[model samples]
Target: MSGGVDSAVAAARAVEAGHEVVGVHLALSRAGGTLRTGSRGCCTIEDAMDARRVADRLGIPFYVWDFSERFRDDVIEDFVSEYRAGRTPNPCMRCNERIKFAALLERALELGFDAVCTGHYAILRDGENGLELHRSSEEAKDQSYVLGVLTADQLAHCLFPLGETPSKALVRAEAEARGLAVASKPDSYDICFIPDGDTRGWLAEKVGTAPGEIVDRSGAVVGSHDGAHAFTVGQRKGLRLGVPAPDGKPRFVLEVRPVSNTVVVGPREALAIAELAGARFTWAGTAPDAPHEEFACDVQVRAHADPVPAVAVVRDGELVIRPDEPLHGVAPGQTAVVYAGTRVLGQCTIDRTVSAVPAAV
Candidate 1:
């Protein structure tokens, strides 16, 4: 349980189903005093206590597993390194891939658990091929994009009770009916470790600031930044450009070149991405029969972003995707989840992007 309404209700349903259920709250951070400010963050001391209360009400075992060290090494460090490499990573994806499903699920199976159930809004159906991951019944609460990293083996041992639920309101009502204390708890948002929601400030402390040039597409120096790591693709504010654009239009961050220590800025149109590819990729259940052949699919770059019609192919040991419509604000290190309708095909950590617009002279 996450000390949230969804998980509490999920636990309740699991218990009602007559299965022995254990609620395990992961202590992802070693900080004991970590507290949720409104709904800004999660996995804190208060969240654990709330989870325990829910477990107590359900009359099931509850344990707070300390996964802080592993989380720091995997998710936190990976976030820092990706930022240093000038790529915008989704830490939630990493946590789900490495910590939640990998580390937690591994330990759960060893302890004789049949499955690791959670409150994630995603569906798992027994398809013709095998078990397949799909989007939730409620489109608004769908989270299959983040769970795309789960392999066939992992998906087999997972259960998501809230996947078929019509709405979050129902989950909250169910929790309240069950007398769970977290029924009215607000949902957590943003990165859990960075409770304050100041990502730039948090990254600055980890990646020390360095003077770097901000250049336009034509190789003209437009501004300077404290650190190239602080900026991301499509960011429009805080450039502090000494020289304004010739057309006086606002310039956006087009790229962050860590090797050159340069922040590339240009017009908003330059943010359109024609192509993106990554070497590191995984299938949700089973690999496509023709892995090297081009396939029609929809590519979702961000968690809440709309999926775009695309053609994907595996060539030269990389998953190359070309969206029919150009994608804006796409950056390396961001995960691109491929979907065929509601079914999650797989995902890849974007290693590179090709701009749709030509460079300005």
Candidate 2:
């Protein structure tokens, strides 16, 4: 059950619902697996132990499968390359799709399980046709944005027992009621590979930083930045400019020029973007069949940001998100999850923003 309160509670809920359940935790990285030998969080070895303990408490079978090589190539490598290409990537989404559900689900099937269950704060409801993935009732902790990458088959064999329950606080309360040890464990956020949350420092070690010129849209040099990878689409602080702006306002990161290794600084308004395009189109349903249909929907390009109304259109082999309102700092390599109310429509990887698009959608 991953040794987390949410997953533990999920396993409990499965039993409460009269389903025979077993726990499985993936050792996604051989290296991270070694770390889990000691304690929880990320790839550490202790988390594996904690998972096994939860399984023992539930009187269910549990096992840790090695998925290191696959995780490195699929999640870690993709995370690095996205930044090298000057785009903000969501590694968690990559992990959920490539590692957790896809890899673990396949492994679970090999072990003779009917379906897989996890701590994800989302749901699946079986209709006359098939199962439909829906956002969790606990919207504050909703994580369907990352899980949107799952295909229809994956969703069918997945059970998200925490879907309709209050999260965090209520999950902890359940854990206490069950007398589980991980009830008070802090929630895990940030990229698991970069456990310390130092993306720039980690990138420097892996990608090698080269100091570059910081400039503005006019092609005039404004300042110097540590490296292009060290900046993102809308970062404002830590520019360390020597001169003040003409209007005496703070400067913000507008663009990252990977070709010249330059970071462009400008007013915050310069970050507004109204269009987004990307590849690797994946939809639980409602895509491919109706590829040309236009639907007004909420498009969320990140995990926690609020979705904005947008018209989705596919053209020239990529998904185009034409937002009805301006979206600030829309970056490539991030996922744009479209939603129709609580139901997820589909998802696409952001390639870049278009010019002269409507101010909103």
RMSD of each: 0.9, 2.9
Query: Taking the tens digit of each residue's C-alpha lDDT, what string does model 1 give over 1-361?
Result: 7788888888888899898999999999887788889898899889999999999999999999999999999999999999999999999999999999999999999999999999999999998999999999988889999999999999999999999999999888888888888888989999999989999999999999999899988888978889999998889988999999998999999889999999989999999999999999999998777879999999999999999999999999899999999999999999999999999999999999999988853
Candidate 2 per-residue lDDT, tens place, 71-103, comes to: 899988998888888888888888888888888
Range of the 10 consecutive residues with the lowest summed lDDT in candidate 2: 32-41
Off by over 4 Å in 2: 32-40, 127-129, 355-361
* Native-structure RMSD, model 2: 2.9
lDDT of 1 at 167: 93
In terms of lDDT, the best-performing candidate is 1
